[model samples]
Target: MILENEIGLSSFRNERQKASISILYTYGFLANCYEQFYKMHGMTNQQYNALRILRDQYPKPVSTSFLREKMLDKMSDASRLVSRLSAKGLVVVTQNPTDKRLVNILISETGHQLISDIDSDLYKLDDLMNGITEEEAVQLTSLLYKVRNSLKSTYDNTVTEEQVHA
Candidate 1:
């Protein structure tokens, strides 16, 4: 179905605007699915993401800064996520010995078990894309990369306050 039919919109300014809105709407749809899935396990998406990162890192502790950079939503508060996860006993936060001001986090045993339980659910969620062929998915990925790269070039060239100061 066309975006118009999907959203009940009469029209968009052009194909470019339509495509942009389509991406955003599709993202919202996917996010809603993820939220519901995560909620069933008693964790928000951000908390799940944090636990996943820590689980992936395993024995190694990761800094809040690293989590911030790796999170799906970069604008979210990593410190707050750690605090919540800590309360849930899903992770352990420790002060960095070398830098007392910095904190590092690792997934706890409960977190690992939680992830193990949810891993299958996450895979099943991906199976929803089985409606599309592998080739179609690859083409969609390529197009998204092209769109992002085009925007990245423009963003990377823009001057920032830190860059100006440096």
Candidate 2:
């Protein structure tokens, strides 16, 4: 598919610019696709991601701050998400006894069941990427990692400068 036509854009300044836009567009499009699938299961993508993280932690209680660090949607309000999940009876939230200021969250039995119920569907959706050969998928993943790694030095420099100013 043509990125220009898909995004209703006629041109880009260069291939790099086009590629950058294409990657963003593809990410949003795929996220929308996942959103639609999860909608039928009565959850949003961010909610699902939070549940997945909590499930990974299992019986262990996690703080919103920790969830925030691990979330794919960094903009998500982790506290709000946890509240919503609690309301749905998918998670248990409690104040840490040792520290009133600290709150903890854990996935409940209902949450585990919900995850089990949705696992097959999620696995099938993930297989959509199977259109590409295994080797191609590996190469694509590596290239994406490389692209991000290439920007690390620039980010480090900016971070250090900001720290100095602060």
Candidate 1 TM-score versus the reference: 0.90
* Best model number under lDDT: 1
lDDT value, residue 20 of candidate 2:
78
- Kindly list the per-residue Cα lDDT of model 1 for residues 27-123, writing each as its tens digit: 9988898888889999989988888889989899999999999998888899989999999899999999999999989999999999889987888
Worst 10 residues of 2 by lDDT: 119-128
List the global CA lDDT of all models.
0.90, 0.89
The lDDT, on a scale of 0 to 1, for candidate 1 is 0.90
Point out the worst 10-residue segment of candidate 1 by lDDT: 153-162
Kindly state the number of residue pairs that clash in model 2. 0
User: How large is the C-alpha RMSD of every model relative to the true structure?
Assistant: 2.3, 1.9
